[model samples]
Target: MKINVPFSIAIAVLSAIIALLGYFIENSLLNQIRSSLLQSAIILAGVALIIGVINMMRVHWVEMRGGKGNKIYHLTFFAGLILTLLLGGWFGMSNPNGYWLYEAVVVPVEASLMAIMAIFLTYLLTKIINRRKDFFSIVFLVTVLVGLLTSAPFLGQEIPFIATGNSIVKSLLHLVSNGAMRGILIGVALGSIATGLRVILGSDRPYGG
Candidate 1:
């Protein structure tokens, strides 16, 4: 069926009104509404997290039993996840005593794994710059080099040229990043409003089907 334009407009207006009210008003009623929505969202997220963990465990368990020797790695991963979750749930994530488990164990392991990605990205960058052989590649390489040089703690403040180069690069980067981010946020907000209205209007019955 064709979308009911009038209905859509009414829903959009209602959403805008509610958002404006929440933004402008600082009263008990608005506070309650805001708190209720925040809490409901948190609860929904928790449920989604639980579902995700269960699905991951199930998939990995199957792989362990029926798939391959690489399955041992999956089993080890799930074991670690479960141990971490249990410890955090029981003792609290912010427990300073157990912080070592997160900082020392988790941080180094994850950082090393992620650092491998940088190597692959560097290889990809080399291939890309080699093939492109144009102003875009040169521009991209210069941007990356300037960013890296500025970020390096030792060279950052010491180098005279780094300051000027960093300023120019940062301005360009910020303009592009912020503009893209704003566009994405607008699209996401519109999509969220549309989905919420659809659910409220009984047009999307996820729980039913």
Candidate 2:
């Protein structure tokens, strides 16, 4: 059957209104409606995640068949996917095998990537500091250096009084980081509000535009 776009948009707008009202108002009916809407959203999110996994698998399968990419990577993807699915299905994913796979494979890869990211960000910050010799840039450069030193356990041990966890410099840097994080959170909140408004007005057709 053909879709009713207007009806869908109306329902979405109404649902958003109900959820918003439920956030501030304290009514049993609104609370129940919001709870149901949240459950539906969770279900839809899971469905979307499954669809995305299937799409990725299909793409990898076609590429594997055509020998378009590295066969090792393609086979590895399928092997990991099948293994995870079987393990999760059989043991409900709450068992030791699933935890072992995650800790052994996923954690190390993530840590390596984070190390690489730290190096890249440090390089980028250095470039910025070099290009702009402003007061803010200079302070930022010093703060980043202190943070890097503080994160190094061996070096911090050697320079205990300077970059140790209890050092005044580290405490100051922590406060600065908290202020910066709060500013970022405010910006994110404003951006989300703008996006939600656009979606509610039916101008942002995230479903199909």
Candidate 3:
């Protein structure tokens, strides 16, 4: 069974109403509703993540058992996940400086992964510049120039425009981050309403599945 248009429309309307109510009223009821909804959403997401972790373990466990691919890669993924959980869980999330487990284990793994990307990025930049030297190459060149100018003190003293450019860059960064986040939130809101409607109408059939 599929969700009917009528139910989807109803859910959209209800979500809109809730949003409006929260915006205008700012009452205890609305506050409670929002808090409860947030808590429930977080819990549900946590459960989903747990399921994902289990699935990852199961898939890789099979691969390891079957001796598929490089044993190094398989062992790396398994060890990394287990170590992260143990370090974060046992020592607490903050890790408290000098604990060393997080820095020693997690930091090195993260650095190793990030360091490999430099090779891929070099190839990508070469291809991009070769194909679209007119537009993309200029954009990439300008980005690197701005990055260097802002980070280095030498350019800032000689060129006042560098300081002004830094401010402009900061503003643009803020606008991009805020706009992208808002877009994501809006998409999530619509998706949530659709999922809620499907569950209510029994079309999703979580119980049956």
Candidate 4:
């Protein structure tokens, strides 16, 4: 594929300038320009998402018309999707009926899926222990057990030691999860900066056709 060097460099330079202005400038005009650009980006994203969903629905509808084996699943998906959209459109999402629909239908479905995932994860852990009697396997099993036990309701109320253990587990979990999330975000930001610099230098041409 041939690279559109000029176009790519232009895009990268413009993006860098806009980003710098947004971050460093305190002028009202600059701030308004930044806000407008952000809003335009958001609007574009929303339109893209809608188009993607419509395309997905169209593909599924075609599959259903073709009498595929998964037609029933596709039908159910479209039915649920259309019903949810209709309800939300007719009555605002905050309306009693819409809220009830979400609470009564969506919440239970999501909860049921989560419950199933917990069972599946437990099964996988047991399988791993049975298959591998290694130190890491033991540690994994112990960690899973500790997490489950600490999070269990009512057990901490009855036992003082369990309450203390739960508090420690919660603290450790929060610290580890937050640290990992921050590391991931930092990595992403750095990667984006590198890519933008590459494009601006005309070393990379993502817009090539």
lDDT of each: 0.73, 0.84, 0.71, 0.77
lDDT of 4: 0.77
How many Å off is the CA of 28 in candidate 2?
1.2
lDDT of 4 by residue, 1-209 (tens): 23565656676667657756788879888788778877887898999999999999988888899987687899888988888888888888989876666888889999999999988977887899689979988977877676665666464363344435448666787688699899999999999989877766667766551
Better of 1 and 3 by lDDT: 1
Backbone clash count, each prediction separately: 0, 0, 0, 0
Candidate 3 TM-score, C-alpha based: 0.54
In terms of lDDT, model 3 sits at 0.71
Best by TM-score: 2
- lDDT digits (tens) for residues 99-143 of candidate 2: 667778889999999999988987898798579979988887877
Predicted structure with the largest lDDT when compared to the true one: 2
Residue 205 CA displacement from its true place in model 4, Å: 6.3
In angstroms, how far off is 174's CA in candidate 4?
A: 7.5
Candidates 1 and 2 compared by lDDT, better number = 2
The reply for model 4, stretches above 4 Å from the true place, is 1-9, 129-137, 151-209
Model 3 CA deviation exceeding 4 Å by range: 1-24, 83-100, 111-123, 153-209
